[model samples]
Target: MTVETPPERPPLTSVDQVNLSDWDFWARPMADRERAFALLRERETPVFFAEPVVTYATPGEGYHAIVRHADVLAISRRPDVFSSGQGGATNIPDMPPEFTEYFGSMINMDDPRHARLRRIVSRAFTPKMIQKFEDDVRVAAAKIVDDLLETGPGCDFVTEVAARLPLKIICDMMGIPERDYRFVFDRSNIILGASDTEYVPADSVDGIVGALLTAGMELQQLVQDLAAHREANPTGDLISSLVNANIDGERLTMQELGSFFILLVVAGNETTRNAISHGLHLLTREPEQKARWLADVDGLAPTAVEEIVRLASPVNYMRRKVTQDIELNGTRYRAGEKAVMFYWSANRDRAVFADPDRFDITRHPNPHVGFGGPGPHFCLGAHLARREITVMFRELLTRVPRIEAGRPERLFSNFINGIKHLPCDF
Candidate 1:
């Protein structure tokens, strides 16, 4: 299985040379993306581009490319004005009704609906709940490392190591049996990596949307079946808690549970895996930074995990819709307009961090919005994500300190800055 390298792109000398909505833009090298975003940030106001046409839905009006840190922060904080519910925060086009059936969770909703759903689900992600899983995370990471060692070097790190921890943790939290782990994993790949030929084959029967819907339906069914069982014979797992009703007597409907499960597995699994993969790649590229972290893995794990996330910006840009005519940092956005908050670009903005492109683990006051911006829609699984990254790296560096990542097989998706495969050796 050979990886096809993307063709060389011309240097982005001007903002006009770039198109945020183009699929080819995302296929460009990371340096080219950096330069292209830098040119956009140089402009006084956000640049607008036409929406990418998808087979599943019609492209709405183009969106403003909100690339700067301040602008992203402003838009994220003002959820009332910049709504995720109008269309959906995950994609540029208004989510088609079919897409929403499987994909529409709280992240795609507004208050009081968003707030209500979040309130119900937030219990599972509380500090106490996350702490309960801390031992499980350690045991999981150790076993993964043990397998990596037994398998020896030249393994696909993304699959053998990075992808396993998050997948297992999320599944375990939901009471998914070990027999169904691969079932959940494959479907997640299709849902997020649909554009990549590796996951949803280009020669498939129904194409991207069909593959997505099929995958979504499979995952929803798996969770629904589990939810039905959990409801009757309740367990301490998240699925049981969600299905049974909280102290407030609020419980998720079957449809809500299905959508939320999809969101949880997809978002929770994919983002953290990419972050871990990117962290290893970053450390490999910057050996000095790697050594710096190695010098004090336990002490610097928090900052190191954060810096990796900041640089990786795993989930990339999230789209928001303007609810009213609003002026943010002198740029005016009209009602019903779309604003794509490029968290990846904002993480590299010069205004906020000194030498923003540098991957320094000691980056103090690291206020990067890798987990989306600070608002109601901020990443629900953030604490778990941080813990996962930290534990995985700690286990790796302490046990396999010399491990290094080879060339990454990057995922060809604008929404996710993902490495589908990463070769590793020590």
Candidate 2:
């Protein structure tokens, strides 16, 4: 998979490189990410300076940049030394100690506990289960597209279609009621928007935090209610499966259920939303590549989705705390320090890619870190995410002619990367 980053504009200066605001986590625009990574890659070392305490793993006391593609693989694979527990899970400014207590959550846990929780959740998100949801995703995507078509051609696609579609689909899979969609959406915005000033915004910070706390409690309560319901009135939705599921012959605790729900909501909605919005924006920006797919009109949209994920790299990076003193990417760090794997940078490493900036949908040997990481923490929702994007492109590229980018609004956060407004005047 020899891909190349096609050269473009110069990297942003350090002043422009600093991330600020509440929405920086999941809503950072694709263009800004390219600028930031381009600057981060300019230094001699593949890795460089990222103020750890300020950017990622904020509560803890260390920061590192394993910017190269190879280094990301090495650190991710060796979870023993680079434990995911503690401040690595999120870049939250002042991480509440309460959140870390339930540190056994799959994303933060290492070895036995991580393994155990992953196993429990893995059963529900299998290929077979996703296959069952294919029609549901298509139906939902079609409805979203049709709604856009109904309102005429020119529309802000990201806000209307991209953000809402997957939110519904994931909620459906999780067995959350439709009445709760607004609530779920609110909390997702808050938790993911915690970093950048753009997404959650200064005015909404208090509301966002308060909403997130309430949302977590609601999820905990819902899981218990659904668990009791499933025990008596067993239906086969994800919630039911979780309630009835047995790990080591025991059901998960309320805290475990909350974390699992958080995982699905945070993981499922934000990434897919970014991929959809960013993909549309890319097609508009790169006419030649967009034209190539529009001409094909068959399964080519799926290929475009892959390119979007590869190039957009919606997940900025997943942080890990080093358990013991270790050396990686020619840099050394002590125990309890944080190593943030900058996926956005690694995906564009010059050494691993040839002319790495070019977007080639038909790039045959695409070994992108967009989905697969080197080891166990690979995204469980990869299949489902792919389904949502594929269905969307199939509906969108065919329905909307000349879907050009019209000034994408950026999210201020550094964690969850995405576009807020992709106004397309089709």
Candidate 3:
């Protein structure tokens, strides 16, 4: 896909120019987005904006744009007052009943239900299992690099390099067959890229919602079939373990399994994919940093991976419903209201990170909320994502030490800071 030139936006001279609800706001240049959020972060109280209208769901009361690092951390810690389940954490607008069946999972839930699901899933991510995944990540990264070398450069880095490792790792963990990899990849792109015209026509709300639901249903059906088979004849894969294991007399229902799988694949795939893509671009732009990392690839891998995620902030914002009237960080929020935590902005908060815009791999004490804030909703796959990034970059820098990224074709959506395509050369 071609990278569409972003329409010229007037300089963000005033906070009034910043509207988090505007679709056009998201499509603006990256520099403009940074300026817009910086303006929002300067305000004493969070700015409230009317919810974006959609045909599938009614627009509720406007949501506060939580841009500061401290506020994001505070609201995350107080899950009792700010709930993820009243409507959903994934979207600003209330998730309609129909959307919940496939989209709803532990991420959009509160305690008891969230705890139960988390507990069940956590059992599968045991130390031994994680070690196994790490081993697989190394092998997968190497294979991906091997293919990239054979194909040579001038390829879309997002697809050729960044998207491959996470997609393969997630699919393998779920016991998805090799033949079905493309099927899963396409569906996930639709689910997350529905707002982008390349994936779904932006003709109407009906078209967007239809594409999303169809992708979700197709994914759920695929998992259900695999889960049914796993139930009868278990294997060493995660699907088999989830299907047969009993955790404190609790088991994930087929619907829960399907939704969780959808969450795992999409969340796991997209976040790491975007991070890797952004990492390449960051390294390319800051060649000195790349040289610094290349001097000691193994030593700097951990810090480099983190710095990339902090800057990438792939899954941009998560919405929460105010459960009670409360005062947090000198701002009062009424009960039955909504607050959207912009992780991307929080990561760039000046109060937290010194020289936040600079790509410093050795950025110590990096308290970035790229993986969500400190709460129960913190990303379950964060460890895996870090591992995937570290391994992928290690392989890339070691093999093709001079690789550089070209202009990126970014996704046109507010939800995810994604690069649909990025050219590369070595």
Candidate 4:
């Protein structure tokens, strides 16, 4: 297929144009390293690969990295040129076959197909639906804060509170059994583990991938059963809604249903979990900012959301392949080459964000790419994710007056940046 081509980007310095090989494409480390590198890239070159030898392929080959704020915003707006269909699944590939196949199911699809699937469930995630979640979010936040107080100070908040609340809510929304909450959480780690190292234990690389496959397989069976259940016993939950949801005069097929179910579970669970963890980390790190936010709960909630999303960027960078030979930023065009957009870099562009490295909670008129770019491929669940974090912070500040990060742990995957152990003393 001849791919739509983006106009040639402006020329870059020799240092900025160094080729990045496959193995060198994504160098996963701690959260701090990513922050530093992102700042550096924005300073030197707005768009460049993570390593030399830009043309190499363990999967997709030869791709450019878009880190500048303007470029990301521009590309995100024009879905036709920077379309996410086909390989637009996410930058990091090589997870489970089921997940890969499921990516092709809908969300990553471009144009008519994406619009078709999205419109089907768009009602379920509409403004009203998002607003209605406040009650659930409040209850969940209260439960977590209460649980933390009952346990007292010195706890890994990410495990005890941050990740679980959203995971639980998302599972509840998807009609997943409570017993399987941890299973869904575990699988989500592997699926989005593209950028962190926590997913890969020492000498246990395959473990992550295995968990992903197993989870995807189990989710498939569970969804199959749920669809059957919905058929017999309809309810008002998302699963039931999806069961009856139709697009283009046709209901979703078995696989499409399964993919939607799994994506909702993974997307909602993982992204919100990171936002909560990162938000707490940011607040605890900056007591003054946290206090200000606490004082102005109603006003600071949105800013807090943007700060955390921009700071965390939980999903990390997604990869895209060039369908045909094309030149980009003075580079020669070559067919079947691979390139990617490193969102980690885009959110920190110096030109867009003042003092890009500093975590500012009250950043005015923030235009961060925490929710991806504009147009058709923008994140649908951003509303829910932001709401969950805001509620958690509002409740958390009420319960815990002072907080500090005790000990922190990050994920092993290079794509989904997250914290495995965020010990916080409150």
Candidate 5:
């Protein structure tokens, strides 16, 4: 297969036209990321960034980087044209069939198939299930804060607090035994943080891929064993619900179940953890906003969560393949071409948001594509994520009002906007 960047025939207008495909760009500190995106936004709203070739898989011609809010929304709304099932959701090039099918969840499937899988999974998130989840979230949040209080505030907030609530809740929902909590957490970190040397050694591209696959397989095996047990004996948990769930006598195949489990483990656990981590860091950076939030967390929390997600954009960009020749604005894209929706940029688009860079908890009419734009592929756990953040912050601020967070140790990957470690003191 050919590996190349889109043919560029435009004069350079800015010095910051750095290729986003460079791993160094993603590994940069958060402050540098802002400057990079700002430069890209100024030079071109939607520009193409060629992906670098890798040892394990060859990245095909790179994707169109859609930065404008309108363009991201337009593409998201038209799944028929921009199909996730065509290309893997991540900006990275194609992987082996086993890896793709085993790792990709419903988010990677187009309609019909996507609808079928989503419908079954949707059954697991009924109103009753959600209420129970909320109750669990409140309890988990309280316990997490209580533990932090006992620890007397000087701790890695990312590991101790931000990662606690969601990981516990997700594990409990899956009926994972308490003994396996640490195992689940470790595997998740390895899966998402493989690109970071702190999580997995930065030995080589193949080594990194090996570690990721090993982590994924370990988690996949765990779920498979659990699914087998659940088959023989049903339980009152989301895993059981998914295991027994059927639509028109359709049930999730073992592979689908495994993929779904991985999705929940990675997406369900990682996204909220990163969001909570960023929330605390943001509050620490802007004490005025923190004070405002403390004043009325309940009244302002609904919008506050939106703002956090808008700013955090934990899952940065998702890839889609063009199904047919189409012209987006003035750029012509052919069939099989790729487009990456930069949620991090779209959330900061000046055209849609006034003072888009400002962190305002009271920002209303927030049409940010933080949870992704309105489309069939919109985040499935968005409601749960919001509730988790709201309740977790409410508990933290109410109990540890003087909490202070240090600079975040960001993850070294373009895929997830993650914080590996965050020091905090109250």
Candidate 6:
């Protein structure tokens, strides 16, 4: 898994190393991150540094940012060594154990626990269910296009278009009431957007922590209520399936159900919504590429979807803990140290992608880590996310041929590459 590193530039100073973990560093424009990671990749393929202490978690020695594609893939494959359970899922410092378990879903668990939960949840998304989901996606896409056609030539694409499909699909799949969609959407945004001022406008640690706790509590209460209702009156949705799911006489506890719901709402919704938003932005920026795709969206979808995922890299990074002392390439990592796989950087690594920076909708051999690397942790929703993105774009391009997106109002965070809003015209 070793990569040939470029010759080191003048060694990074203490100040330069410190910036790597600072939230302000991530809040900079996407291009800034590109330049920073490029410099690190060339001079220090696997750099070790401490994470900046955020208001929500206790400060501690941080992680090694795995920037190369080979290293990222290798680490992702060997989940036993680079364990998620030892630390939390995000690159942030550790939170209270209860908080981590309540919010981390199966993602933060290792081995048997992750395996058991995945198995139960997997049953709900069987081939038959996925086919139905795909059909539902197409119908949702068509309806979205029709609405946009009636209301546009102009709208906020993030709100009016890109964000709608995932939200609707997830709510319907979970059997959530239509009235609760806005509440679920808001809470999910707050949870993911904790670092952003728009969601948590606090200068002090206590204020930020308070906001986050409040949001988490509300979401948890809602899910718990829903679980109780589903238990009493089951329906043909994911919640009901999870409510009654049995594997060797084992079923999900109320706590596990709540966490799974949170994960589904955030991961299932945010990843695809951001990808669709970024896809519109990419196409608008590269009309030539847009034209090529518009010429045959259905034909180009397989590759186009991969390109969008790669370029978006919506979920920026996931943290892993070193199970024991190890050396990667020339860098030595001790047991309990953290490794943050920068999928955003790996997707653009020259070793894997040709003309890595270019937006090529027809890219082949696109083994992007956008869904995540191989392992038990690879995204369960990957196929569904792809279908949603493919169908939505196909419908938009085919039906609203003249539609275009303007500059995005980006989300301010290091964890998620989110687009808060995008002005668009048809």
Candidate 1 TM-score to native: 0.98
Clashing pairs in 1: none
**Model 6 C-alpha lDDT per residue in residues 1-426, reported as the tens digit of each score:** 011222434333343543667666665556667777776777555777778777556777767888888888888888878888875776457756657545868988898999999998987665666788887899999998899988877689988888889999999999888898889888888878877677666554557667666777777778788879988899888888888878898899988888888888899898899999999999999999999998887999999999999999999999888898877766787888888898998999987899999999999989999999999999988888988998999898888877889889888777899998999987
Of candidates 5 and 4, the better by TM-score: 5
Score residue 374 of candidate 3 by CA lDDT. 96
List model 5 lDDT by residue over 79-162, tens digit each.
988898875776468655757655778888899999999988986666666777887889899999889989886799999999
Question: Under the 3 Å rule for N, CA and C atoms, how many clashes does model 5 have?
Answer: 0
lDDT of 1 by residue, 76-97 (tens): 9999999999878898888888
Candidate 3 wrong stretches, greater than 4 Å: 1-6, 203-206
For each candidate in turn, give its C-alpha RMSD to the true structure in angstroms. 1.7, 5.5, 1.8, 6.7, 4.3, 5.1
- lDDT of candidates 1 onward, in order: 0.92, 0.71, 0.91, 0.68, 0.83, 0.82
| Best TM-score among the predictions, by candidate number | 1
Which ten residues in a row are the worst by lDDT in model 2?
20-29
Ranking by TM-score: 1, 3, 5, 6, 2, 4
List model 3 lDDT by residue over 129-156, tens digit each. Answer: 6777887899999999999999998999
The best-first sequence of candidates by lDDT reads 1, 3, 5, 6, 2, 4
Compute the lDDT for candidate 3: 0.91
Better of 1 and 6 by TM-score: 1
- Per lDDT, the best of the predicted structures is 1
- Comparing 3 and 6 on lDDT, the stronger one: 3
lDDT score, candidate 6, position 248: 91
Given candidate 6, what's the lDDT at residue 85? 80
* Candidate 6 residue spans exceeding 4 A from truth: 1-18, 203-206
Estimate TM-scores for all models: 0.98, 0.87, 0.97, 0.85, 0.94, 0.93
